[model samples]
Target: MNSTTQATLIKVPAVTLGFWIIKILATTLGETGGDAVSMSMALGYLISSALFMLLFVAMVLWQIRATDFQPLRYWATILASTTVGTTLADFATRSLGIGYGGGSLLLLTLLGLTLFCWQRLLGTIDITSVSNTKAQLFYWLTIMFSQTLGTALGDWTADSTDLGYLFAAGVFSGLLLFIVLLAYFSHISRTALFWAAFVLTRPLGAVVGDFLDKPLAQGGLELSRYSASAALLTSMLLLIILLPQRAALKTH
Candidate 1:
C-alpha cells in the first residue's frame, strides 16, 4: 500500500500476543490506580469518575486527531478509558446502590446496543475498520462500556459467590483461554473472538488488582494500591517499548 493508504490505516495496534499482554497490564493498572485515587485517597467514586472521565475525553480527542497510528497515544487512551470505566462502574454499582449484578446488566445492555448500532451503521465491527472518526467513536464507546461491564462482573463474581479474588481471576483467565482455543480450532468469527478476549481480560485484571491490594482479612494481600499501580504501569510501558507497535492494516 502507498503512504496515503498507510496513513489512513486503523489507529489501533495490530492484534498480537504483545498487544494482549500490555492490555492486561493496563487494565490491572486501571483497577489499582483507580482505587488509589478513589478509595485510598478518599476522593470518592463520583469525583474520581469525573476526573478520570475528563482525562479519557481529552486522550480520545487527541487520539482521534492524530494523523496516523501512534502507539503511545493509543495506549494512553486505552488506559484512560479503563481507569474511567473502573470508577464509573464502582459508582454505579456501589454508590448508586445498583449492585454488581444490576450494574453489569446495565452496562452489558449498553455495550450490546452500541455494538448493534455500530454494526448496523458500518456493516462491520472489526477493529481494522476503525480508520475514520465515526468508526473510532464507536470503537472507543464500545470499549468503555466493555471495561465498565468487566469491572462490575468481576466484583460480582468475587464478592457475591464467595469465590474470592484469585478464584475470580482464574475464572476469567479460563474463559480467555477458551476464547483463544476457539480462535485457533473453530470457524468462529475472528472479530467476535477478539471482542470476547478483550472483554474477559478486563475482569481478569480487575480481580487480580483486587487481590493485590485488598486486606488479608478480605483474602487480598493488602499491598499498597499506589505501589501496585506503579509497578503495573512500568511493566506496560516496558512491554510497549520492547515490542513492535504497528497499526492494524485496514481491510476493505
Candidate 2:
C-alpha cells in the first residue's frame, strides 16, 4: 500500500494476546487511578468523571488525527476510556443512587443500543471494518460503553451480590477464558466473541483494582491507589515497548 492508501486504513491495533494484556493493564490503572482522584483526593465521582472525560476527549482526538496506528496513541486512548469509565460508572451507581444493578442495566442498554446502531448503519460491527471516520467513532463509542458497563458489573458482583472482590474477579476472568476458548474452538461469530471478551476484561480489572485498594476490614489489601496506578502504568509501558503492535493488514 502506498502512503495515502496506508493512511486510509484503520488506525487501530489488531487484536492479539499483547492487545488483551495491555487492555487489562489499562483497565486496572483506570480503576486505581480513578479512585485515587475521586476517593483518595476526595474529588467525588462527578468531578473525577469530568476530569477523565476531558482526558478521554483529548486522547481520542489525537488518535483520530493520526495517519496510522501508533501504539502509544492507541493505548493512551484506551487508558482514557477506562479512567473515564471508572468514574462515570461510579457516579451513575453511587452518586446518582442508581445502585450497581441499575447502573449496570442502564449501561448495558446503552451499549446494546450503540452496537445495534453501528451494525445497522455499517451492516457489520467487526473491528476489521473499522477504517472510516464514522466506523471509528462507533468503535470508540462502543468501547466507552463497554468500559463503563464493566465497572458497574464488577462492582455489582463484588458488592451488591456479596460475591466479594476475588470471587467477582474470578467470575469475570472465567468468562473471558470461556470466550477465548469459543473463539478458538467454536463456530461462534468472531465479532461477537471479540466484543464479549472485550467487555469481560474490564470487570476483571475492576475487581482486581478494588481488591488492591479496598480496606482490610472489607477484605482488601488496602494498597495505595497511587502506588497501584503507577505500578500498572509502568507495567503497561514496558509491555508496550516489548510488544509489536501493528494495524490489521488490508487483505481485501
155 in model 1: Cα distance from truth in Å?
0.5
Model 2: what TM-score? Answer: 0.96
As a TM-score, model 1 comes out at 0.98
lDDT of 2 by residue, 66-158 (tens): 777888888999999999999999999999998999999999999999999999999899887878888888999999999999999999999
Q: Could you give candidate 1's per-residue lDDT for residues 1-252 as a string of tens digits? A: 864576556799889999999999999999999999999999999999999999999998998898888888899999998999899999999999999999999999999999999999999999988988899999999999999999999999999899999999999999999999999899999999999899999998899999999999999999999999989998999998899988888555
- In candidate 1, list every pair of residues with a backbone clash: none
Task: Give the TM-score of each candidate.
Answer: 0.98, 0.96
Distance from true location, Cα of 137 in model 1, Å: 0.3
Query: Global lDDT of each model?
Result: 0.92, 0.91
Off by over 4 Å in 1: 1-4
User: What's the lDDT for residue 206 in model 2?
Assistant: 95
